[model samples]
Target chain A: MIARRIIVLLLLLGALAEAWPAAQTLVLVVRRDSPVTDLDSVTVRKLFLGVPVLINGTPLRPIRNRSEPHLDEIFLQQIVAMSQPSYDRQILNGVNRQGWLAPSEAASVTRVAAELNANPNAVSFMWERDVAHNPNLRVLRVLWSD
Target chain B: MVRLTHSLWVRMMSVVLIILAALAPLLYLGVSRIVEDGYQERFINSVRAYSRLVADQLEALDAAEFERRAGAVLDGVVLSGQVVFAQIVDGERKIHSSITPALGAASPREDYTFGQSPDQVYYISHQVRRPDHAVVLRLGFDEIPTSERIRATQRHVLLAIGGFVAVSIGLALWLSAVIARPMVLLQESAKRVASGDVHVQLQSHSSIREVAELNLHLERMRQELVGTNEQLTREIAEREASEHKRLTLERRLLHRERIVALGTLAGGVAHEINNIITPILLYAQMALDELPASSDLRADLQRVVESAHRARNLVWRILTFSRQSDTQAPSTVFALRAPVEDALALLRAIVPTNIEVVFRCEAEGVQLTGDPNFVQQVVFNLCTNAHQAMRRDGGRITVTLAAEEDPGEPQLRPGRYGVLEVSDTGEGIDPAALPHIFEPFFTTREVGEGTGLGLSVVHGIVESMGGLITVRSASKLGTTFRVYLPVAVALSNAAGAA
Candidate 1:
């Protein structure tokens, strides 16, 4: 009984430790052929928060990563710097008032990569480690780093 | 019918029902509250989660062509079974689901909890972020599922309660039987005993000690009562026999005294009658000597003398019946058959030929210690009375002479006796006249037909000897006279009458 309880306790602590945010250098990515190379943190935040932005006469659209574990939470915490509800609320406000479209969400790494390559203005946030093996995608800028 | 209101079974059932009445409401209320709250919380939480999801979709909509696309988002919310109404509220702008019902009747009221609204709808709102603006997304979830679930749970609870109540009543019935069975049996048994049927022994079918003990006591009491009743019955019978004996003795004594008084009076009357009739007889004989042979007056004179002679003989018989014998004549043991046959022969000659005199003597040598003349007279008188009784419709006069070894009467000494049974198939003596039959001059015949002294003389003759006389007669049936006399045993003054 003691051994089983100790194992369960260790597992729970591991999960809690994993759940705590750690310093990560999150960068915005786009297709290598895209015109956009870097964006300032302020514009990146507004774009991710459902603000309508255009770069070099092309409409900028943000794509959110859904399938990556805890990627949305980390992005919201570091880049958006807002709670999930607050972030969603800001985006919905812009859509309702200006009739603007909100950011699109992709469910997998390949899906995010596909969106980035297809749309030149499409940008998405992910850990830099995930972008390393995808040669077709390039980091536009460091979205956040500890 | 047993009165259920006062019965043990009813009492037991009442207690069980009272307990159920007390607990059923508490159980129903407690269970209903738990089910309602659980379903309510679950419903509110689920509706809130679905509303948040709809808000998420609103926030995720693309800005370009947002108007056309947002309509699809709202319609999707309406398509989901949980939400019946969906809308987005922005400053100075409102967007409702295209498929939502027209709400011109009433605006949706937001619900804080699942069951807080009467519309069976739980309304909630979530804010969605938009570019420089946040919009409120309101969703109304249908609460029917939660309400139906609660109702189903409550039905199950009610079924459980009902089952419990049924089982309790069954148990109460069984318990009441266990308690009331012995008492009911005892009560029925007690009723039978009260109705005087105590032959059945009181018994206990109860396992309870007190009931068994009570039965034992009651059984003892019943036995005691039976014994006491038996003793009282025996005492009553014996006392009745004693009273009858005393009355019989009194009657016999009174009859004897009357006979004695009548004998004294007859003796005196006979002496006077003899003196008067003797002179008349001598004068008539003297006149007859003087009368001429051709004279008709001679015959009439002769009748006067004849009647005078009859009066003389009657006075003589009266002397004998009155026991005016100079000294008590020596009573001799004699052949009973000879005298009985002689009396019957004389009776046959004198009575109507239709009254056949039949004599039977079974005891050939049975001798009685009384005077033979007394037996002869007794036979003559009883036979004469029988002859008179049957004069209207003549019948057989049977003279049965048998030697009785056992006395027929209880007052008689145990000895050999000659029972002379003289039975006549003739008109019987009246029952009202039966008691006075042996008394002097008491007869059913008309005065000119009989002197009514036949049975009186017979009773006197038997009593003077050591004997008893009993007569049995029924109206229109027949008359029988049984005369029992001691055989060859001198018993003086043995007078008994029946």
Candidate 2:
């Protein structure tokens, strides 16, 4: 009886292991504004939170990604350095002012940038690969290595 | 209702055996394949290492000399216990061998023969090279060691498989015993239940939970079956009693209907006879008035007068229908209060003195279309039945009459239905018996005390006159009998219009 139970348990565990999903990575992309090549954790967080800041003293707003799996706290700690709660609090504090917008994906960042350039007040984030220049939009400088 | 195609034991045994059978081939092939693969892996690794060694060694020699020296080196290695023989061949199929005697005997001589030989031996090959070109070198081994290792592995695998199969068989036997025994018991219990022994009980004690659960189900089924049997028996007995009462009630109702028909027939005959007698009496009286006192016609006149008297005697038969409380004839329209009072008066005489009878005749100007005497009989019967129900002591009977209207059904009309409710503060009638009460001769009273015809007569008269009667009673609440009759024909007709 015990043996039979063990066999059944093994089969059930096997089935469970087979159902688990593969692990994935979350990446951050930035464009150059100064020779300052890669991003620091603090500046990435501040820009994503739409804290009005200067890059060579030009006021800028950063964009965010809206895709799932939504960037969790772990992703923030390792990459963006700001928790989702802190991000939401910052957004709520500046709701009426021009704030950062999360494009649907990295590809839409160019469109958002073009739209933002036309409006002067609007700004958004997109994937680095999707940010080839249309005449209207330019990459703002941020901090990062490779 | 869901039937199993396979019993637990059979299914378990088949699965165990099939698993064992499958494992036998799998274990044999797997162990042998693993052993062979291990040996082959070692052989290939050794061949690679040995080829590198031979190539390094042969680098200083000319190509032809290299083949010859390589063959000698290979022969030296083969002279060791594990190796059989070795050969060196140029790219052409001509072999230079240290074992020239063995090669002379081998058919289809070639420069390099590798893999398993036709004699069922395992061999390994490598390319020996000079700077310009390469030569192939082969080493042959007897393969006895690999075979022996494989046989040993086979033996271990067989032992392991044998051990597992033995354990599985023992387990299967034990599991089948655990599962099959309880199932067999349950099957037996089911058979017994089918054969009309629902009282049998199943005791479940098994390591196998499913079997234990089955035994519990069997036990529950038995309990349910026993309960259903008891309920069925009770229902059957009640039905039989009801049937008996219904038959008696039917007999009484038929008798009452017959009596009423007889009364109507008598009334018709009496009317015809009375009509015939009226003219005869008129003629006789006229003749008596006109006849002279001195004439012999006086004696004849006296005879005529006597005949008229006899005819008058015959008219009394019509008075039978005029009985105050007879259970025959259709009732006529009358003031409802009088008949209700008259009925209570008669019941007062018959009921025990301890029982109090109260009458509230609040309904006035109320009339009904049935015979007053028959209505009185109905009221009297209902009161007496209620009184008898309260035979223990100090019971109160409340009789109430009121003028009310039908709720709807314009054809039945709305106005002036006289409600006569007789309520008794007594032990209530059983609800089981309530529907049967109106059926003739259906009575809770013992035989001879009641013919059970009272409610049937009540129902018949009430229905015949286009009225309604209802009763309500329960174990907790006392009994109430309500009779509703139309007060006047005109009022009913007018209400129909309204």
User: Best lDDT goes to which candidate?
Assistant: 1
For model 1, state the Cα shift of residue B215 in Å: 5.7
lDDT of 1 by residue, B1-498 (tens): 458688887888888999999998889889999999877756654565566556666767777756787778888878877778777777667888888775421456545555666788766655455666666667777889879999999999999998988898898888778778877888888889889887768875778888888888888999998898889989999999889988988887897788789988987898899889988999999999899999898999999999999988777767666766443558677888988888888887899888888888787777777578788889998888888888878999999988766664776887678889999998788888887887666767766877666777677678777688998998788999999987774432242211
Query: What proportion of the true contacts does each candidate reproduce?
Result: 0.00, 0.00
Best-fitting candidate, scored by TM-score:
1
Error of model 2, residue B262, in angstroms: 3.3
- Identify the runs in model 2 with alpha carbons over 4 angstroms from their true place: A1-146, B1-16, B26-34, B37-253, B264-335, B338-357, B361-398, B402-484, B493-498
Chain B TM-score, all predictions listed:
0.62, 0.38
Q: State each model's CA lDDT, in order.
A: 0.78, 0.62
Chain A agreement with the truth for model 2, given as TM-score? 0.42
DockQ of each: 0.02, 0.01
Model 1 chain B: worst 10 consecutive residues (lDDT sum): B489-498
